[model samples]
Target: MSVKPGAADTSAAVTTASWLPLIVVVLTQIQASFAVNALTVSMAGITTDLDTPATSVGTAITAGTFAMAAFILLGAKIGARYGTRLVFQIAVAIHGLAMAAVALSQSPAMLFVAQAASGAVIALIAPALTVFIATNFSGDQQAKAIGYLAAAIPAAGVLALLIAGSFATTIGWRYSFALVVALAVVNLVLSFRVKPVPPQKDITIDWAGAAIAAVAVILLSFGFSGLNSWGVILATDAAPFSVIGVSPAAILIVLGTICAQGFFQWTRSRKAQNKPQLFNLDVLKTGAERATTICMATMMFVGTAANFLIPLYMQIIQGRSSLQTSFSIIPYTLSIFIASTVVARLYKTYSPRLIARAGFVVVAAGLILLAFTIRGDWHQIFVVIGLITLGLGQGAIVALVFNTLLTAAPKELAGDVGAWRGLVHNMSGSVGIAVASVFAVGILGTLVSSQLIDNPTIPASLKVESGINLDQVNFVPNDQLVVTLENTSATQAQIDEAIRINTEARLRALRTSLLVLAGLSLLAIIPAGRMPNEVPALEEPQPTKGKK
Candidate 1:
């Protein structure tokens, strides 16, 4: 591979350096992971403390994720223009301050602001990690480093579940964010030891492309995340505004998709003009690269949807405590951690196409198993096995696709590749949770409305008298439902019937949603088959005139 003229030569230093830089990179990954996971594990406490609905927390998560996806392309360019090491240090410090804000948050709005700030900074850190690895490691060592970086996500999740769960249950949710602040500080202090590459003065930030990308991502993120609350196609009462009676969510999605096409067209124009592009389109020029992106997005969609559904089922439907929910998820998180760390060993023995195809198959089977085996009980052995199976597949694909992208791209384009990967992960994850919620709640609403009409116990007259709107139905615990009915003229028998209907509808909705995800997983096998038959060799750097 031809290296740009101004690119630093650190091959000799990289080969002789110790693993300290990798350690710093891994810690940085962990800090970001911990912030998100801690919020997830402490959902109950957050809702209670802030006196807000669960959807508010979901909004906060989406805001942060959307912010990251929106700005990551620009972030990659920023790292190249301003030294990656310096940018990384600043981002880490800012992230720590954001965590502190989260710890001190007095309301849901404060939490959202803090999390969004953290995510924007993470855009800088995410690309830098990949650049660091590409700059500091080579050959097998680089492969191993990517694997470790991938594993850190689930590993941090495990730690968050254990530590945050305990804190939320025993003390307060604020402690978890406090812990993240401390980790950020440690990462900052250790970052000074990492090798630094000189900034590329020739690279120019593409402000127009960045604006298009940011607007497109923001629209798509809000559109998907608001499907349930705002209405899939029609405007709901909860929708802040609408377009000619159509939901803003639907309109936003269409606009966002159009803007996305505009972004690509803009990039092409910039390339034609011989100007610095927002990202190197060549990073995704090949069929294999496109396929890898699809596979990565699909894996994240399935994993994140399952992750959202499981916790909702345990905590909301079953009324399990936060700590108990964390315990139930332990097997799944641990499986991911173990699989991510070890899957690198399989690259030499098996083709990536084969492994990726098998991984998707396993993921589909796991979802199907969970869909069928889930009962009122969350402690069933089959449930545990299903979770583990899903995690293993997700972990393997996560590491596999990332390593493939990095190895295939020239080192000069490493930051672009990383930015693309981060964009996929965040955008897909947000869409996954949104789609899952829409499916589960929409299905539940339909089933409940139909059951109310069919069940002899729930009279049509009662339904009319109760003033309940079928279209606006939401998933609530039985106890909460009972409390709601207490205000009405509902008799004991009517209330019991409503609870029974809710119980059955929730389970059926979950099963149907899982089946839908399983079908999506099976479809992903098409792209998985298109991945490189074997891992691609890293390109050796050769000097050339600087051309971004």
Candidate 2:
């Protein structure tokens, strides 16, 4: 039943294809996307239910993405050794079980573990989706299928927001994950109808490289995530451990960077020795491919940061309900879905470099608009416009960069391309959320402390007596702040002043964070310029180069 390496299944040709397989692929994608997005929309409920901070949900998100980035290259090889269909089906089943664990999670620890498990399973599913398309379809049909798969990410977000938001509001956040469990069962059933890809039995798994990659990513994720809690430059009270008075976050980041370099060096040595590589370096042999990766990572970082910031502001800062937060961000998610679906039309007319550069400009403009216009209201016309504009740029770039990479590489390396894509996407997303939280929270803490010190209305004696650690301030709703202050010796007037200071400080912090992200969006344009000036024609793959 095994086909020759890189050979397509002619039975599933474009003219003869039923499109049912694409549906299965897209639905499988939605299953994972919904799990992540459901967690995002349910952030408020999760914090209350688990008696944890909002940052705990962000940590869970970081854990999931970090696990995926760490293991995806290995997952791609696993899919190649085993049959893609069999591995994908098993991953989907395991992912379903993970989602059920998330639904039943009683603590933040349980939630983080469940999410990380789901992410590891997605590493298998992500590459399989690409391999399925490469093996089953040819020509424009393959292009069309890839577009649908990309669009499904944002489409899943919209669905999760509505469904999960409703469930979180009406019943509880747990029901949202229960719904994903159902979707997983459905996806698993439909997967049987998809075209099968035979295993490449000769493919070897690089265990050493996998171990290096996993350790590197784990360190980087924890480093970035702990920057605030563990102190940016020195160990804080919250840090579990430190190295020579320096923050463990800083130490971990340095070690991670070194390990990442070592991984590449080890892979290069493996390539020279004619041994199997954990990832196919040939996929990135060209500058255009490398640039495409940078562009992809930048877009994901900015987009994820913005997405996280908006919801954090709405739910945690403004005290909006989960359903209300979902409704507010609908325009953004809907725009992403629409843009991802239709961006392929431009591939024929414009070069990727042109489209990608223009997309960055649009994204920068949107972020800048958001920074200046946001206020007490989340329903403003300008805010909605900004969200739509940002989403449009994000969607177009995500789809375009992915398509460009796939077209540029030979068909045999499709899984590698997909693995690299998933790695960059998830790694950047994890860092994005981590950095955004740190920046926003850090700024808020600084502003609150400064204001608390200088304010003449609040007596210094009362501040000292309040016992609130200004250095460790966190974002809390005004009512909660008031209750805490009321329990202390502070009078009503002092509580009112504290509330005013917190409100203004939170707004200022968010504005500052958005502006910084907009600057990053502008910087990404440099890499976009290095993308392919012309569309890459999908040529028949060259023969396998002797199997490494």
Candidate 3:
């Protein structure tokens, strides 16, 4: 029997259809990239148009991030019960509406609410995407496709910043969100093309588990974001308990953990004999998988921190235009795309662990170089870090973790494991952004405070030169640091000096943060080593598979 081209050939159909699932997954991730960076790129215009305080605007971002972390697993459950295709449609609609609402927000409350809604969509869609791909694809296709999905996010982010920044500058920041609505529509159309996979028959969403997880993530995110806010954490010296009780960090660590543990116990109690449980305890039981997951999150966190800081520094300190700011981030997008799409494939032959470990070493060395060599002549350091160091680390992490996690998971529970992995990665991204914001605020404030004390003779000029209006500066830094700096009133010499100082501070902070990431990256080596050295021989799913 001669095989007809693109007709009645199972292998060809599978190959063509394989790409469709990946496309769907990539589309889902794109929504999040826009959500995270749209606000960042549009911050300047949004703040001005809405007449909201900068800190309030910053808090809106925090709210969105918290909402995502809280709701991601819930999304996965939805995908499991219904099919991923159905869930994707609903998510796209919600996310699109949220974006539209964000564009029309009249108050900070409206903005925060809209952002949170969008974040929830982001949280759910990401895991659903991973689960969908895991269930649909097999063997090397799974690893390579996951890498593409992983790479698509950062690439989308870079494009979003560029487009948003350009549009926000020319038209308005509110208008920039129109892109999301458009993207959502395109993604919605794309979703129709994705074939439905078998659905989980016995899906049970643990509401208590979901609730506890949400509360815990919100509290933890808040706590991490408020790291610089000692007063918020400590309250008054006389009433420290009040501060402690309200502190997100404290609640997440102490109360959140209790809730999470209770949820786990509840899941165990509810699980039937030989039935798979939500949040598989077995996955965590594997030391290598556990470490790999943690490392996955940390890698995303550190990369996000760099992405967050570089833009703010460029805009706030360098006074670049939005278009210029976005352009500067091009290297990151290019590098990550190349590594994810190209380098990831080589993992089949080379040890993924070695590739990932080398990535961290390069990243650490790059960060150190950036920290030590930041001066007036060292403006190109951002590109080096983004293109080479950060890009390599991110690429390898995607390739390594996706490959390792897939290998470790049994065929029946692949979707769940993939969802869990996506959860760790996305939540870590939020945590990273929040943590970076905290550090950025502290860095700006401390620098300004010191400058004021040192140059009391020229305090007014110093204030302007340092780019520190404590209230406004506390707002999250985006890719527009250059623009923010240009808006300041420092003379050339003073501007140069300020850039010099801030650059050093940022570089040093980046070094410290990346070192933490390097340590985390090394942790994955053990787990990757434990992964099966070769792919198992391909076999079709048995007719009596437990999933359906």
> What CA RMSD would you report for each candidate?
5.3, 5.9, 7.2
Predicted structure 1: lDDT: 0.89
5-53, model 3: which lDDT tens digit per residue?
A: 2232254223323477777678667766866787977777778878887
Top candidate (TM-score): 1
Query: Cα miss at 223, model 3 (Å)?
Result: 1.4
Instruction: List the candidate numbers ranked by TM-score, top first.
Output: 1, 2, 3
Residue-level lDDT of model 2, residues 1-548, one tens digit each, is: 22232343364322445688888889999999989989998998999999999999988987788888889999999999898899999999999999999999999999999999998999999999988877766555666788889899988888987788789889999999998899999989989988778898999899999999989988987888788789888899889998888999999999999999999999999999999989999988999889999999999999999998998889877799767777888889888888888887776667889899999999999998998888888878999899999999998899889988887877778899889989888779878887888889889999998998868888788877777788788788888888878878887788888999999999899999999998998998999999988767654333345643
Cα lDDT of candidate 3 equals 0.65
lDDT of each: 0.89, 0.87, 0.65
Tens digits of per-residue lDDT, candidate 1, 1-548, equal 42222244355322334688899999999999999989988898999998999989978987788889999999999999999999999999999999999999999999999999999999999999999999987665777889899999988888888898889889899999998999999999998988887899899899999999999999998899789889999999999999899998999999999999999999999999998899899999999989999999999999999998988888877899767887889899988888888888777667788889999999999999999998888889999999999999988999989998998898888899899999999889888998899888899989998898778887777777777788888778899988878787889998999999999999899889999999999999999999887667654434333743
TM-score of each: 0.91, 0.88, 0.77
lDDT of 1 at 488: 78
Model 1, residue pairs in steric clash: none
Model 3 segments more than 4 A misplaced: 1-18, 231-248, 269-277, 312-324, 381-387, 411-415, 433-548
